[model samples]
Target chain A: MKDDVTIINCQLINKAQALKDVSFEVKKGEIFGLIGPDGAGKTTLFRILTSLISADSGQATVDGLDVATDFRELRKHIGYMPGRFSLYQDLSVEENLQFFATIFNTTVEENYYLIQDIYKQIEPFKRRRAGKLSGGMKQKLALSCALIHKPVVLFLDEPTTGVDPVSRKEFWEMLKKLKTEGVTIVVSTPYMDEAQLCDRIALIQHGKILSVETPEKIIAGFPKKLYQAHSENNYLLLLEVRKNPEVKSAFMSGEYLHIVFNGEADETVPNLKEIGPSIEDCFVYLIEN
Target chain B: MIIKIDNLTKCFGDFTAVDHITFSVGKGEIFGFLGANGAGKTTAMRMFCGLSKPTSGEGRVAGYDIAKQPEMVKKNIGYMSQKFSLYEDLKVWENIRLFAGIYGLDGKQISRKTDITLKRIGLMNEKNTLVKELPLGWKQKLAFSVAIFHEPKIVFLDEPTGGVDPIARRQFWEMIYEAAEKGITVFVTTHYMDEAEYCNRVSIMVDGRIKVLDTPGRLKDRFHAKNMDEVFRQLAR
Candidate 1:
């Protein structure tokens, strides 16, 4: 597959390094996720790659165009939905979409097909002010506006951070449909569960990439034997498990405590059931190690 | 009960945001409030926190009437929102002191509590560090500690662990467990399904009403699901 986006040795420093030697490549028509917690420099990398800001050093290219010098042309072929709500609050949903289309030298009707699925959900409130819409409705409007020009690449920063479970599922479905249309997506999110939806993900922390691989590969790479220690009092169990000398890491995992042993198992802890590690476990382990 | 509500409803003109929701939370219980976006969770939560008036309802939070004694309700409860709970410009100790004062603690008590909180969170050395300079996890922990600094009968946390890391998130939960142990009722809302399991009981709201309310274990069995995520998906769908 052809590379749609490439970031090489990107570094941004402002008193402290926002991104340190970040490097990655996104293949055409693939969903690439930059997974990390807040303040992990996902936005910084997105800004540099989308040509919104220049990196202090290193190179980035989108769709064969240089992010620095060919930014003006690049802007036309890429859509960016920032992490924060940046749409004009006073503008109606229809007006917002129209405004974005006109600024891109296009019309809503020109590329209506691109945003038709998402736009239909919010079209009933087309005349309502963007500010009056609910969070989910506003998100739909923003996505439609971003796609109005039929951009080849879409950059969504934490699009589902606060969205509920069902809405998040629907949003990911929308992304899948967009991928079928060959729109390469570069998304960043703090949710580890969402990492599985991407073709590839880079686990970033403290402005550095920990591992870049498919979700399954990352989970497979989890080093220790993870267990779900079932107990009536998980909080107490957690504290007790952490006190054990053989325990590597222990934390609550739903109904049970997820504990990882260092080398050998401790028979004293009853119901020490083994389970596969999730991307979240891998992420915590990578960060600690 | 720390919180009791009956037929609580909030209407904005013709649109009903919270539709005759009725539920009660026991004292010292960790109650999870679950809902989809625009599902009336925030609206209902605001009424519980006394930040917004209910269009019509009968409710009591921390033994104070939500509608008739909103001030008393506010005074007896601690509230924190994920978006704007702390001041970025203030130092760690300054934020603690400021909140403690607002909660009606005296100067001496504020100073004493500030030191205790910083030490508990292992941020004693960073007392003068700006809140913004601290990591997001630490800031969240500090904000939570400050929210309950006055030892309010009940504490409301709105999506407190939104983007926190796994380790820090568990640590935050530990703090909540400790508070609940100290007999402070915890009312928390979160989108993370795994967190739902930690709650003693959870109410899943849909549209504008409480559709399902039960313990995670019972809810999973009733829904015939493996985890809270599946149960939530079923209710949300």
Candidate 2:
């Protein structure tokens, strides 16, 4: 299989010891996910791969070029959208896109076909200031600017964190289209639900990779049988369920209390029904015992 | 009822920010106000909390007329936002104490309640650290604890769990439920449809109007949708 991005034991020990022995590979035309919490070092890894920051140890390559040796050429083949909005807020949407294009020695018209699908969504607001755009509109504009260079590998970090549900759904759809166009899209999100959209995901926590598997396989590996109990008082139900020796762990999930039984024993709570674990459940299980 | 609103409406020039939306919040109930961006949910909430003046109609929050007695309403309710306002330079314990002082809590009361709060949230060790030194999850939880430290009748949270991971979000919801058990009304706004399930009742707004208001189960069944996300999509469309 052809790999568009590869990392080998990347380590960084900046302020808080960000990354440690992190490594992952993304195949060409695949949507790879780095899923984790806020301090999980996802951003640090993206920076190293994008040639913004050099790793303390290990090596990374983008599109078959060494990230350290071919740093200059590597910059042209990659586009990175940082965790926070990094565009010129004072400039209009079209101005931001044109600025990035000019810096890359290219023009928006030159790469019109590359970012046409994304650009057209926000084209109506082309004259509006970037800062005045809504959260979803700002994200779309940032994505359009990132693709203005027509790079091979696209890096998106927590693009939909504060966006509404409808916009989040639409953003994922756009990413799926980009994948079909042979762009190796690497995105990171704290929301496990978004992980399901990626072709493959790596669950990271505390600067360490917990598991690397497809969303289905990861959930399938949840060791114990899970059950959901709905009682009048969910908080009380959580306390009561945890006190049971037969229960391994119990946590409130939305309206229901999700529990993992110690073993298949009798003494089931009334109205207890078996359920499947979601990506978040699997992530919690992987992080803890 | 902890809150009572009748024909609440607000306008800016020729645009109506909130239409004649009438609703009441029961004491100790977890009420969810959900909507897409640019919807009137925020405006309605602002009216209830006495932050914005309504062009017409009236409401009483905590038995204080929102229009006539905005000061009393402000004193009786707690408000926390996604962009939490905390003194980043101050230590965690100092921030808590500062809020306590603002609410006119005696030193003894402040010490006792904060001790219990620290133990409850498992943040005893972090009390002496600067607020900026804490992680995002911990900081959010701390902000919530301070918001309710005054023990107001109703707590208004604006997208309280935005950008938080699932684990922290789950724990945050659990805390909200625990507060509800103590007869403290929780009024919150969020973009997350999943969080709406935990509310005793939810209201969705669109274009300055209340589109639907009901329990999560009933709303889903009525709209013939599997989840609140679908319900919202159907309404927003």
Candidate 3:
């Protein structure tokens, strides 16, 4: 498949240097993830690609149309779900969906097949006000609205930020299903674990791309020998592991403290055993050095 | 027990936000309350914290009946919301003073506690800086310090690490452990499945009902899953 989205040295500057010569490509029918923290340039890049904001320099094209001049035409071929909730809270679920469809010069019935999987989940609450819906329900409704137009490419910014664990899992399932139907998905998330869900992910920090590769490849690229350990005192264990001269990095992951040894191991922490790096472990290793 | 609830329920109009539920939390236990949005976790927590009266049933915190002695409950417990609850324009030290005074610390005691807290959270150098100037991680840590400055027996956190970076989240969990070690029971609500694993025990609520309550390991074993994320999906499904 051809590259549906192509970006070259996309740079944007505001009060601070928002993006620094960022460039990447999204192939057709692929799930591309932009993973980063709160202040990272993920949002700014999404804005540029969606044609909501212009870049200071460089170029970005979606479906062979320049994002700079062909934004109006580009809008027709791309759908965007912003980081924050962007639905009419006062409107009912059905009304909001209809409103989005009408603005796109289409009708809900016209793209019924496009949103069938997601829309069916919230169809029971069609008459309920969007404001009154739960966080998870609102997300499904927002996604359905984003899909109403059946755009070839979808840009989702932190689509699962404040949603619960169950809802987060369900939402990702919906994304995967959408991918099978041939939607080019570009999603940004701060959650590192979610990176593995995407076909390929870019580890971004401070408006810069640290690494962009498939989750497995990123993990395989983890340079140091990693270890996962736990003791009665995880915080103390972390402090102890850092004191070791051979240790490169030590981080807490839930109940276990993940460690990276530079050379021969010193036994400051109990139950320290060599292990493969998870996406989060790889991310911390990338940024800490 | 630091917290005890029996058959607690809260209803609004025709909607039952919290169904009849019973649970008890031991002193210094890190208890996690897990739920989908509008699953009645917030309503249940408010009733426990004495901020809202339960429609029916009984709740006791710090040996005080929440329904009858809300003032007593408030005095013995500290609460922190997702927003961190710090005045943005105020200086870092000033926020500590404000909370310390509200918790009824005397003038001399307030100053002593403020110094201790500023030093503990490693904000002694930036105590005079405006709260808004501090980073999200520091702001959250300071907010937690102020909540516990009064030395409350229990601290209730609602989504404490909403948008913090991964490293800050690790440091925050360490602070939580330090608090728990100090014999202060932590009752926290969060959407992060990994955070749930750090708790001593977690309760999953669905549609105003507590579907399951157990240690993370047990919950995972019961659901035949490898992690809290999978366990949550099984119960919530």
Candidate 4:
């Protein structure tokens, strides 16, 4: 399917539709994001593309190799970092890196340059047990292990979910640098705001993709007039605005309420002046309508 | 003030988990502790709750010296760990009773508190279910409610919403707000930028030092960031 690093359309069990007729492509050297909340089937998609599991019914391929048939060949070209910390906790940081490298039939020194930037940050703590390293350091160590084999396609599942803001920033910066070096990255995150950081993002909800576009394009596609409204009572304002017939929807954004108007903006603001909307206004408009 | 930390530091061998960091939380304030994974927020919190000893530093919680009167501090504060700390094999009610017992609650008080907590978290219908049988969201909520079973003066939550759904997170925050309204201080650490904005004041730590500490609005203005993510990016650089 198209010269993509990955393409999939599969379904899991009934507990989760888990990718209902989903089809997407990750162009070479591009950072593609799968944005969705937990149980939105992000992990299932990653596993299928990585050839760890086969989809119930769908054609899938990564790097010109069939995911269901060319499992071994596909494994050689893809690196996966699971959402949870899955590296061996009993191993030292250095040992874990070396272990992953060995599993890929490579040496840490052989691909040292590929992971040199991230590895160096945790090199000083090389002797520390994997379980004992700080969260940021653990994240770096995990990335280093993932890249130790110098794979062409990297799949990260919610890599920044629990990471601190600084670590999350550092991780994204590293991903950008990796992209410059010609690596195709496919990362998933539940945080909608992170959708802006990627080259393009596919917004998935309840196992179905709602939209696929650049963050700017998606935000610009917002259909109704939006406004930020704040009053002495923010929560009550949101509840009151949602009940108005002219208002499409209302949700909280930081200290203010974002309200979307179904009618003209001029008339809506005065009516909503008694209530209010802001960024939450834009988000609600998109979600509800 | 519900919590006070002064020059709090903790070290193991040659590595320092938490460096000298000082902060205080007033009653009813939702204080957010922001930091990288290993930036020492957890260590600093543990010390304040008397879970871990500080290599050096002085602290107090609920008007008791942390270093000298750790038991008193423990008695006054509730803690929810980053890891799922509840006993998996225990029923939801049993787990609640265990925590209540740890805080020295009597039989009648534990029963009364357990009923209220189960109902508050919307898990009263599943009180007899084993914790392991519940979903991740329910487990997280139950753990949070258990931590505060004794009506602690202050509650410390360490990455309490890591793997739950967004709707569950919103509900959890509502509970936190309810607690705050009852005059209990909330001390929490999180990586989610949206969650950070909910705190009354926040501290961002990097490399074992607190680099930014202020109300989210003030921090946003001071850093000239459109959002917390941008503020983090600027400070991280």
Predictions in order: lDDT? 0.89, 0.88, 0.88, 0.78
What lDDT tens digits, residue by residue, belong to model 3 across residues B152-206? 9999999998867677787888899889888999999988898898898999999
Docking quality (DockQ) for each candidate:
0.67, 0.71, 0.63, 0.42
Candidate 3 lDDT (Cα, whole model)?
0.88
Shift in Å, residue B235, candidate 3: 1.4
Model 4 ranges with Cα > 4 A deviation = A5-8, A14-18, A231-249, A261-289, B7-20, B54-57, B106-120, B124-130, B133-135, B163-167, B206-212, B233-237
- Note the B-chain TM-score for every model: 0.99, 0.97, 0.98, 0.95
**Model 2 stretches with alpha carbons more than 4 Å out:** A15-17
Kindly list the per-residue Cα lDDT of model 4 for residues B65-163, writing each as its tens digit: 888888898999888975866999999999988888988889998897788777767888999999888766678888888887788999889889886
Query: In model 2, how large is the Cα lDDT of residue B39?
Result: 85
Among incorrect, acceptable, medium and high, the docking class of model 2 is medium
Tens digit of lDDT per residue, candidate 1, span A1-289?
A: 7789988998899654489999988999999998876678888888888898899999988999999999999999999999899999999999999999999999999999989999999999999999999877888888898899999899999888778888788889999999999999999877777888999999888899988999989888887888888776777777788899999878777677888888887878868888898888888788778
- What is the C-alpha lDDT profile of model 3 across A127-222, one tens digit per residue? 999999888888899999999999999999988878888778889998988899999999987676777899999878888898789998998998
DockQ of 2: 0.71
Give me the displacement of residue A3 in model 4, in angstroms. Answer: 2.7
Q: After superposition, how far is residue B99 of candidate 3 from its true place, in Å?
A: 2.7
Which pairs of residues collide in model 3? none
Which residue window of length 10 is worst by lDDT in model 1 chain B?
B162-171
- List the pairs of residues colliding in candidate 1: none
Task: State each model's C-alpha RMSD to the native.
Answer: 1.5, 1.4, 2.2, 3.8
